[model samples]
Target: MFRRTFWFTSGVAAGVWATTKVNRKLKQLTPESLAAAAANKAVEAGHRLKDRAVGFALDVRANMAQREAELEDALGLHADPELPPARRHAAIENRNKPKSYVIDRTTHTHNRNEDH
Candidate 1:
């Protein structure tokens, strides 16, 4: 019984040591690994921004389509099936605006959802 116990205890000790050595090596992230991690984060951010922009564009398109349909109904003219509704609204807005306006490029503030 004593001999069996000794062998078991020694086996457990060896296993524990081997596991610690492997874990220590794995914990060391090389410079390449760090760079890859940063690249992945940047790619993820780019994808998220693209998705948000697409969603915003879709929403604007839907609103403009609704408005254009209303305008067509009011004018008693058939809506040009070839013209995209969003472009029509954009054209109207552009025509109504002042020709020149200065952009205030001042200190920018971020909302809770925006990155600093």
Candidate 2:
């Protein structure tokens, strides 16, 4: 009789525990809880993406610097770390100047006449 009572009590306790666990899981699976979990996952993914982008940018910059150094070495050109502002402005202006080419007008005219 004692054994039967103990087993019944044990079974009741196990059933209650299982019901509580299932209820808790069902609550977590509710719409609001699921939405919150999805939002958290999205935020985590965004953070990971941002970190990867920053790392990629740093790698690209390093590679560009290395390539520039190699090019300078191959061309026997030394990089000037600092230059006067006026000189820098002048260099930029010169680089922006349009090139002028002198074409032979007579040859062009003859070619046009022949084409016609």
Candidate 3:
């Protein structure tokens, strides 16, 4: 029984010594040091994000210019033919069509009634 008690006490002492060493090493890894490392990583990430955003903006501009050129080319192929002088003269007469209106007092009265 005495030998067992001695072995247990020695084991407890060794454990306490090991724990102290581990605690000392952990203390070296301070919150301030950890926070600075985190800040540096964040700054690097932000720089990468800014670079990606600029690249995307440049790509969008390139695509837009290509799309515009394609549309202009398509429109050129379907150009309208010039109208003959007689047809042009007759078309001008059609533009002077008489305009007429019926007084919509009923609609106005209905709108007012709905408002009330």
Candidate 4:
């Protein structure tokens, strides 16, 4: 009689466990849950693809810059860009000469080209 009672209790516990597990699995199989899972996976894939594309673009930019530097070096076009270009427009002696100005009392004006 004791063995019969123990077997009955065990059978009920097993059935309850199986029922709960099956219900949980059924909930996961519903359409809304499946759609949410798929959307989450797609978003993850999109993020990975975007990261790869960004890395590829960065690599291409670096290569382009390296190639440009190589071409500039090969063509002998590299020069310092910070210094101002020298333009010798005036003679060396004329640069230091001062202009004379004469103030005339008749007109109350200063003439630059008149002899003092």
Which of candidates 1 and 4 reaches a greater TM-score?
A: 4
The TM-scores, one per candidate, come to: 0.49, 0.66, 0.42, 0.60
- Please state the error at residue 28 of candidate 3 in Å: 6.2
Tens-digit lDDT track of model 1 for 1-116 = 99999999999999999999998777647677778889999999999999999999999999997997899889897857788654323334454556455344474444679865
What clash pairs does model 2 have?
Answer: none
Pairs that collide, model 3: none
Error of 1 at 11 (Å): 6.8
Off by over 4 Å in 4: 81-116
Report the poorest 10 consecutive residues by lDDT, candidate 4. Answer: 94-103
- Residue by residue across 53-79, what tens digits does model 3's lDDT show? 999999999999799779968887433
Question: What's each prediction's clash count?
Answer: 0, 0, 0, 0
The local distance difference test score of each candidate is 0.82, 0.86, 0.80, 0.89
Which is the better candidate, 2 or 4, if ranked by TM-score? 2
TM-score comparison, 1 vs 3, better candidate: 1
Which model scores highest in TM-score? 2
Q: Residue by residue across 7-94, what tens digits does model 4's lDDT show?
A: 9999999999999999999999999999999999999999999999999999999999899789989999785789675455865555
Candidate 1 lDDT score at position 66 = 98
Q: By summed lDDT, which 10 consecutive residues of candidate 3 come out lowest?
A: 83-92
Alpha carbon lDDT at 87, candidate 4: 57
RMSD of each: 11.1, 14.1, 16.7, 21.1
